[model samples]
Target: MRKFWSKFKREDGQVMIIFAFAMVVLIGFAALVIDVGTVQVAKRRMQTAAEAAALAGAQDLPKTAEAISAANTVAKLNGGSLIRTTVKAPYQGNSNQIEVICTINVQYSFARILGFTDTDVSGRAVAQKNPQWAGEALPFLNLDDDYLANPKIVAWEKTAPGDFESLWPDDYNVYFGGKFDDHSKTYFTVDFADGITVTKGTVATVKQEIGYIYGQKKPVYIFSLSSAVIKSGKYNNIKNKDVVPLEDLVLLQVTFDSFDEQDKNLFLTTTKVFDINKGEYPTDYLTSPGGTSATIVE
Candidate 1:
């Protein structure tokens, strides 16, 4: 009898108790693995959606109403919703930056049995738009001091009448890469050589080619050739020229008046860019605001 009692005490009959505790711990580990993976997937999806939202918003910088509307639309399509947003025009000192926040609810499977059914997942993203962009240059002589009057197309002829004189295409070939007769605005831009110079006498050739369409917009980049106006490029010595340079860049809106095929002459009107730099309103807008590139900052 004493031996039986001693053996019973040694066994302790704790197998069921140990197994109950171990089962609880094992279920917790399984839940951690499975639920953690589910949450992570949700987080990744939300992050992508946030990124898309931020990019959409960045496209319309300074236009907060339009930016927010675009961001929300993209977020909904990407299986997430934007919770908060921030816009910084002239963001980070130069580029226009936009930040988007998004969130999602991840449902738990095995973790539901442990009293945790779902969790809220969130993500954030940021994007920036460059303030400066490159544009084709007029490659001509400066018109006047008046901001209203820009490049002088044929010695101060905003709208010239009578017979046109055929222009020498060789001088303008550097500015117009292809056939100019198409009259298509698509050919308005020309990529210049890195070291090319354009001053008053820089273009020694008289030019003509292609036909200019009336009212067609010939947007070009304008720069100050006067060292007095721009202190940075005083060494270039290229005065009385109209062109796009790295320094003192400005935006010019060029519009053609009329062209006579027989006369072989060109006429156009150009004005300062303040009216179109997203309007004349006070903002961090540069001379020209539309750029071709965008990037994700965060």
Candidate 2:
């Protein structure tokens, strides 16, 4: 009995058994880290796709079919197939609000061993169409007051330096006179002296406004002369009409095509106002009834 007890106390093979158990635990931790990291990468990709889709759809708000088509195109471009999407036009009865929900399936790399073959990811965004030009806008004004009531394509002609100074003198005619004063003529000129009411009232501010419009290649909404009431047909009267320069202009919106410095001509791309309340804009016109803007909500 004493000899049997001595043999039973031997520690042979004990270290091997402990090492085997430790190896299994270490392997499991490695799998968890690798799989989790892969999923995180896929989640980020899905998020990017969702944001792009939402912005694309928002640009075509109020039009159910067009909005969906635009969203799908953007999702596909981002390398992920859209699993599902929800588009709400005029969200919450607001004509300008557009909401979009996007979902995608993300494949797993190392998670298959844990029975998670793939995971689903989702993203959402909301965009609003501004009702009108809110603040600082391009300085160009429309040719006729009638353009404000009904927006359409209008052409602008450049005035010779001599003619520009003669038509819009600084002393007598402080305001730059163009199509707004001469309905019979289509020719126009940039009245640098009193062309626009700069919000900042600085030379830099004036240059900024002009530079923005001149540099734009895409169609965008800008303030036109039609937006102004133009009482007594002068600039001094502009201050009394409760209108803010570069802010309030009945010329709610205008789309520019090209500004030719040499020929001195300004052209418009297109001007069609169907459901002016929810219509399409030129180059997705300035975000009102025919405009678009996007933001991520979720």
Where model 2 places Cα greater than 4 Å from the true spot, the runs are: 1-16, 82-99, 107-110, 131-291
- Model 1 TM: 0.51
Task: Kindly list the per-residue Cα lDDT of model 1 for residues 126-244, writing each as its tens digit.
Answer: 88764444433444323223334344433222212211211113223332234643334322222332222333331223233334323334444332233233344333344322233
lDDT of each: 0.51, 0.47
Best model number under TM-score: 1
Kindly give the number of clashing pairs for every candidate.
8, 9
The local lDDT score (0 to 100) that residue 81 gets in candidate 2 is 52
Lowest lDDT sum, 10 consecutive residues, model 2, at 165-174
